[model samples]
Target: MLDSPLSARLEASERILVAGAGGGFDVYAGLPLALALRDQGKEVHLANLSFSRLESLDIDAWLDEDVAVIGPDTASRDWYFPERALARWLDAQGLPATVYAFPKVGVRPLRAAYARLIGRLGVDTIVLVDGGTDILMRGDEAGLGTPVEDMASLAAVHGLDLREKIVACLGFGVDAYHGVNHVQVLENLAALERDGAYLGAFSLSRATKPGALYLDAVAHARSEMPDYPSIVNGSIAAAVRGEFGDVRFTARTRGSELFINPLMALYFAVDLDGLARRSLYLERIEDTVLARQVAAVIAAYRDEIRPRPPKAFPH
Candidate 1:
């Protein structure tokens, strides 16, 4: 039997922070991992790069200039707030209700905010969770789906001087809507494996407790925000429940055909430092103060490079 490095890494840490790399319900994708860690007597916390307007939050809601503490009652005007909805679900389930939220700012402030949260929570380990594998893309990929926020989170966490730092990406092909090529995603993973940064992959099984809870949490979140359910998580949840091939739940997938297959339940893990080092453009945005600046840096890099032509997965 192969010993799992991902399990060993989690076992080595006492205080862990599992954060959503991309905004929205990306953090929900971490629910299973976080729950597993907690069951092992590790103190785990949840957070996200928020899609909600943090500015709308009352001054008291802020943990600092960049981090906000969002509980069940936290106020927000947005129709879609995955953080608060997740909080409510947690509260109802008798778990911790507070979900930390950070503005989708540039590397500079986002890094600072991450540092503050680590200090406040006394976190020794950080697991940056990306709902999709786009975070694994090196700049030259034919389609790096919505890399802005994902890269921002990766770059920001890379700046942290933590003892244990890892990244876990779920919902494999869910980023297709944003144009991520799965072939390029696999190629990047192989490269990371060469660098010894690939932590190994695991799949979620709805038959287990963590997997069942993940399905419940995702369903509860979707129920809480019926008007704007998360397509990424919805598809992941559907796949986890053993659904496949264009299975639709919400109207979010009305037109597009979806392949809700077993692969979507798989998680590809990697070490944050090696992953960050592999990035061709993260250094360019390290000094940025605004989120748009990070986007600009990526755009400039993309313009300068000749991306590999998109390749279809040859079955």
Candidate 2:
């Protein structure tokens, strides 16, 4: 189970946040994993910034069925229920958590409100998926009357110290149709970090050859420093390839060809909910006992699986 090398740091976080850009459908991908963690008795939360495409989907139907409406036009209903229902479901599962989907509010109040809530809740770890807001914030370097650094700045502003906290990133190949590819996304992320020590990430459903190359790279790198947080790759490939005991990494189809973004997205959400609630950690070095149990099941098929390369389609 330790073979897949998911981040060990994540197991130690209690407060978490799953964040991503608005256009991609990764959030929908994350829902089922979040639900599963609830079944395993972990607290989790889901957060999508306001104006995210995720907010425009059919919240009512998704809550009822946990389905994703990949395109904005497929189904229409009040999108509020999914967020509310997710919260209600968490409570029902004996996990105390909330889901916050932010809207495209004017810069001023949105920053203030975000900081206030984080402060009130005392968040710990933040799971960022294909999000550039952290880097964008750094490029702008304008403070929101709250000390903002990087994406981690959000937590810092709310008085959440991340020096000892964990941040999990299931960063992977983005939808070929939505945004930059996986490599480009990581290239940008590398530019944003000063020390690579705290970052942990994993890949999902990339083209087969590249996925294998990436898996090999991350695995070799992480095994060397077993103490550093694990950066997982290939798990998405494993999940999709059915190497991990029929468990799914994605619950819904992504706008991309592979339709594998949701599993990674929801996994981040479940982890964040646990982090935000302080249920993901155990002794702060080892991952929270609750999270490790799940990762154990998830990490098993590292060798048994391989992703099928995406097929070329006629233009």
Candidate 3:
């Protein structure tokens, strides 16, 4: 007696883990979902495929051979520690306070690290959250839009033995900078629905508490690191503020005008098991131990496969 597939899977889950599939600010995309789910009284943990230098962290910070516990107090000479930055913001808001960070590694080590984290947290549900829709690409897209880290998270978590694993992408129309085609993105989602992997899509409203908090978090992150503000969140924030096409926000998009449309505010979800089953090349990098190795494997597979023609929005 489940109202929806996502609810049915999440029904028995007591502790949930929301992780960023891609490195960098991708974890910020999970803020709204994490906040909304927290409102339902579920215990949630946040983690990320971090672009930070985990090797530089002190031994005490290491939770496992591959994972590190990042907090607001965590210090680094490196300017790009998204995990610590997020932890700081969470602390300022008196939220969960600690964010777990996994190094940008391949499927083998990444999977091992994820298994350890799952064991430590006793997590019943693992949600792979992506900042953009690129994670939906099924290996035959004309462009995969920086698939390395996203696919690594996908393959790594796919190898885990878990009751419920889901993928929820928050920001849409943001990966176009990396040449992702949204028409093909829709086509892949339709195919996943046929395979029973598509979990349905929802939009984030700025009026909601979670959405308002998310907007605040994104704004705070931008203020903390103005030079490297997230284009994805900027677009999503603009859409939430009721902006329309071709609106300008950051200097990065000065030459290339952005389409600040509503789609950027939506979250498209799918079943991890079904999505893994549909992958044409995930198996190729299963044994990879380095990020470069994973990239090489995907490149070779794309070279061998006949890619689907890129489609454009007909409207």
* Tens digits of lDDT, candidate 2, 229-272: 12122234344343533333333332323433334321221122
Where in model 2 is the C-alpha error above 4 Å? 1-8, 19-43, 52-97, 130-171, 186-194, 202-315
Q: lDDT for every model?
A: 0.91, 0.35, 0.89
Q: How does residue 215 of candidate 1 score in lDDT?
A: 92
- Measured on C-alpha atoms, candidate 2 has an lDDT of 0.35
Model 2 misses residue 203 by how many Å? Answer: 6.7
Q: Rank the candidates by lDDT, best first.
A: 1, 3, 2
Q: In candidate 2, residue 302 scores what lDDT?
A: 22
lDDT of 1 by residue, 19-116 (tens): 99999888998999998888889999999999999888899999988999999999888777899998998899899988999998999999999999
> What are the TM-scores, per candidate, against the unseen true structure?
0.98, 0.41, 0.97
Candidate 3: residue pairs that collide: none
Measured by lDDT, the strongest candidate is 1
Per-model tally of clashing residue pairs: 0, 20, 0
